[model samples]
Target: MSIPTGDVPIGATVLALAEGATLTPVWANEIGGFTFRAQRADGTTRYIKYGPHNAEVSMFDEAERLSWANQYLRVPVVVQVGADHTHEWLVTEAIDGASAVDPRWIAEPRTAVTAIGRGLRRLHDALPVSECAWLWDPYSRIAGAEARGLTVPDRLRTPPSDDVLVVCHGDACAPNTLLDDAGNPIAHVDFGALGLGDRWSDIAVASMSTEWNYGPGYEDLLIEAYGVEPDRDRLAYYRDLWNAT
Candidate 1:
């Protein structure tokens, strides 16, 4: 189904009733969904996200997870939730930060990479695993993708030899990391895939994004900031698995 990429119908309903509110969609991704920054007439801003057809489960799960984590993590506040868990939308308080893809970060890749690394480490260190109940395990995702008939690139379909695990952001792409005016990471978004998994799952996937978004010579910096040498074998293994599933 074609993904919706602008002001959500639900968001429109909310704004129409809200005094002097205007909604502007700021970001949209293929597999995920669209995010709208709602500027209320009161000068207050909130964010609303709606997914492509059949993405309600992911959207709703993300909202619930975000709501639970808001107690501890400096994450967005989920203000409103849809009635049904399916065919739904999520609303959150607007966060003050720019995405890593923002022009500022595009020009300052080193600082942006460092911020991502530090932010990720903080998440890994601070979030108490005992309280969370989810598994973003790659093995399950592979099976789900297959069931959905989504083509898993042959390159991304293998199991890794290393299995040291940690709580991961799951989808740690450049766009998910939010930076402040000073280029420090303030918050993270896109938690649909957040869960307990191998540390390599996060490291490999994030480092690999450098190739797609930032070009060469930056992967090493990410590894350095991650405070570990590149695990080439694990990197190759998970990347191929990610592509496939």
Candidate 2:
């Protein structure tokens, strides 16, 4: 779909509240499906995210999930939510870090890859799965996407008959990972797709994304950092499915 533009109501409100607040756009693109930035005022900065869409199942739900995950995981904490005729917005406290795709990180692929891998492992190991209230099972996700007219890759439309479910960052692209100045991953973002699913569901997509976002030969580094051999079949399958969606 075309990217939405013009002033977003929710974003405008946050910017107004921080009346004299210094604000800089961090991400404003099509894929993220929202606009966000760092708002600084009085030496403190808050990460503000908002979209010019109805605060319905997707954006609002994600806002709730991210807010809740902060109580348990090292993710951003939502500070506010509001909606208007043109949009819905969620503001959150900013974490101290930069996107893993930053030039500093690009200059140190090994460090970036290692940090991402380790962080992924930590998330997979630490998130309290038994209690999370959502389920992003691939089968269900595929069905939902299809119902919404989102094309699904044939391979992913049918659920694999034999994979145990675990909590996964449904969209585990490298950019979603944030790193500290020291190159350590401090937190993750975009929990809209968080759910119970196969470990490979995440690993597969994340591994392939390394190549897409960072370039050649980095997939192995990410896999190594995650402490697993690459599952070529799963990676190929899921990567294709991800591209289709």
Per-candidate TM-scores read 0.85, 0.87
Give per-residue lDDT, candidate 1, residue 153. 64
**What is the Cα root-mean-square deviation between model 1 and the actual structure?**
3.5
- Per TM-score, the best of the predicted structures is 2
lDDT of 1 by residue, 43-148 (tens): 7888877655452236677877787777768888878766443335678888889887777788889998888877777777767777778776767777677787
Candidate 2's displacement at residue 167, Å, is 1.0
lDDT of 2 by residue, 1-245 (tens): 22246663344476664556665555664634455565565676776666567321466777877876777679987777777777666677778898787778888888888888888887888777897888767677776767768878566766554354567888787888999989998899878778787777888777777776678888888888988887777677666666665
- For candidate 1, the per-residue lDDT at 169 reads 79
Clash list (residue pairs), candidate 2: 166-197
Structure candidate 1, residue pairs in collision: 20-41, 152-244, 153-244, 155-240, 156-240, 156-241, 156-244, 157-241
The CA lDDT at 138 in model 1 is 69
